[model samples]
Target: MNDLGKLEDLPADYRAELTSHNLVPLWPSLRGVLPPGKPRPNTRATFWAYNTIKPLLLKAGELTPIEKAERRVLVLANPGHGLEKMQASAAMYLGMQLLLPGEWAPSHRHTPNAVRMIVEGEGAYTTVDGEKCPMSRGDLILTPTGLWHEHGHDGDQPVVWLDVLDLPLVYYMEASYHINGERQTVQPGRGDRQYARGGMLPTPVFERSAKTYPMLRYPWAEARAALLTMGEDMPQQEAVQLTYVNPETGEDAENILGFYALMLRPGQSLRLPARSPACVFHVIEGGADITVEDQAFSLTEADTCCAPGYTAVTLKNRHADKPTFVFMADESPLHRKLGVYENRG
Candidate 1:
């Protein structure tokens, strides 16, 4: 490879003429856009401690009412992308949302796909397209793109949940917008109950479900139990993991991002291969030490972290007597859709 010529090396009049016509040369910046070996990602390894976020979130609740703020949230912005951008990774947006008791977040639908990982509190529920999904610690509630969703709480304390969304990508593509709507009429059946067990689905004998999203909420109890059962059944497996997928098609739960639950055995350390998609990890139960290349984050329950693409990550269960459960979200589906997914193990 040879050193590329700098833009300043070109004649001043030629540069002026090019600027006048809104034209620019690519040779000087070619290697930058087409970097060798791997991508020079701007997404860095970042961590957000739940303990630190909770206090600020409570203060936010006290400072602003639900009617005034609509959705009171504190974004877990990565410093690499600039805090103002409100992005956890290149394509993912993360925020800690606080909903106080007796409050309701009005109904609205947006273009970006989103999921809520409940961190704490009870008696809070999210109604997505009319299905009322109760909020429990570690539950995952989906508010997929263009689906009207709202939050309501009947509990005494403040309810906080980690909000993960594909907003950065959608906003970058200029398709990010929301439409307000009236309160939805609560539907009759819950999807989780209909598609409860593995290898079985509600027989759509009468007619196929017209709903684009059959299941909006994935209870943590089911996922945790599945991980425990798998751990016992397949003790030799390195990673006891389960993907959150659409039961009907056996595909990822949402289109742009992939969601999963991972379990680490007592005193176990698992190394994930370097893959070409940024990943976000949240501790659902127990503590774990996450190492992303040279950066290390000690994550307790409810804590979250992000790792950039093409970086090998290692996770270790800090507890020696119990298993550690983690919830992960990644850009794999989007990468595969763009035909750039890879695992460089």
Candidate 2:
């Protein structure tokens, strides 16, 4: 009687399923037989870097000898985000570029649109497809897909600027490619060359392509300086930093890969809405303690920090002598598409 063996070899799940469905049809409760969390949903994060990215810019003399001697095209890539899931169409990145007292970022071009915000140091110019424009701190420049460009600074001090490109966009599109120009890197010509060098009434000679980009440079420094001069007695905005717009379309260019500069007087603090795009901050002069998404960071001249999106932000000037000046970036172009807001004048 004890010679009979038990069904130890059979898995419990299979046995239960067989027992339940032996003589049955597809019943509604059959699905309940499985475990509660089997084949779970993907609740993990798709991106790696914090929505906020931090960058530290260098002037010519500040870097090591080796760093200064090389091709000075500095780049900040995704901070290693979207590691697995890979959100390509959307781009989130930041970087700071420094063209020493006499350095140049050679001629090159690729896909995935780009934008730059000049921070400090000037007498630098960027030549896109041979169209040149001297860059000044607080100006905005756009380099759309497939445009050839290069950078050089013949100024006294090193020219440093913020660089924002949607590398993720190129990676996502699976069309990523790059190339280096001649030995000198730049187009071997001087200020006499490029677009800005042409007469005052500047316009693209040949359509560089469709409505790729209208204006090469948006002089943010001059514009912001004017705004301050015009609104000397205006009440300060509580938490909102002013946005820069396209003069023609009134579209908020600041939201796209662009930069905005502001000066905060001593003891003055600005509170900003939480929904704005993540911003990277570089101190131009003086010092400040920034509250990003309520997270705090102490910064001074040459110091760098970042603020994430979907969280409120505030900037407080903590220094007495020099006024604190800050430069920031965001997805301002997309902001225009959504019609959530705009930048005028």
Candidate 3:
């Protein structure tokens, strides 16, 4: 193919006029926006060690009070996108949030969808809408778009969790904002318990539950147990993974991102095919060595990493006797919805 014309080839006066009229030529920049083969993603292979983040997060708790800072969080910003952007990927934002004992993150609802992966702590709970979801190590609690949510810690120690949100995407679309609300009245039932068992849902005889988000909190216990059981039952499967989905509709838990729990058997090394969606991996239990493209990361408990789209990734369980469990969030749902999802095996 012939090379496109350059803007420099044009006369100075013509170029000046084009710039003055905000009508620059596209030939010079066409290939940049529509590059051949695949996209050149700004989201790079980045890792955040929990050991390193924990101390900083604890110090942040001491330095800034909840009342003053509102939500004390240390954003896990990717260098590829610049630190000030506070983005882990093109569409995902990640931060480590701390809630000390007796601290309360006031009630507010936002336009971006978010979920909390409890890293460490006890006696901390998040109330979404009206459900008081307890915070335990490895639990995932959703504070979906426009849903009232707040955090409260009753235990005697500090509590911390990984905050994953679709703020970047929403902000880019100019639809990111939140509204403050009064303290919520605790509800009666828990969604995790109501939708506990698989292959069955609460069938309403009269009318279905009006709530758009039926299950807001996904307990790690159930997910871990399911992975262990799957490993035993399907011993031949290379990737013993389970998607966190709505039991009623059998879809991804949230609309913009897909959440999953993956288990690697002892001494297992699994290779994931190159797919057209950026993904974030958080270690829920055990240790694993991960390689994204040419970059490698050694992740332990509570560690988090992000891999760019259209790149193959490899995960290996570091333990010889115990399995490694990882929680993953990806842009697959958004890609599929936009008709651009791909799996280039």
lDDT of 3 at 336: 100
What range of 10 consecutive residues in model 1 has the weakest lDDT sum? Answer: 1-10
Give the per-residue lDDT of model 1 (tens digit) for 193-253.
8988999999889998988789888999999999999999999999899999998989999
> Which rank order by TM-score, best down to worst?
1, 3, 2
Give lDDT for model 3.
Answer: 0.95
The residue pairs that clash in candidate 1, if any, are none
lDDT, each prediction: 0.96, 0.56, 0.95
Q: What lDDT score goes with residue 49 in model 2?
A: 23
Clashes of 1: 0
lDDT of 2 by residue, 1-345 (tens): 223334455567866887787743333334445424332211111121211322334433355442345444344432224334332123545556667666666677777666777766778988876657778766777766677777877888767666666665457679878776642333343322223321242344874434335456766555556445534656564322455544434455433454566667667877766553455566655777887543577776645665544455678999765456666655555555667433221
TM agreement with the true structure for every prediction? 0.99, 0.61, 0.99
lDDT of 1 at 149: 96
Error of 3 at 259 (Å): 0.4
**lDDT (Cα) of model 2:** 0.56
* lDDT digits (tens) for residues 1-345 of candidate 3: 739888888999999998899997888889988999999999999999999999998898888889999999999999999999999999999999999999899999999999999999899999999999999999999999999999999999899999999999999999999999999999899899999999889989999988888999999999999999999999999999999998778889999999999999999999999999999999999999999988899999999999999999999999999999999999999999999999999
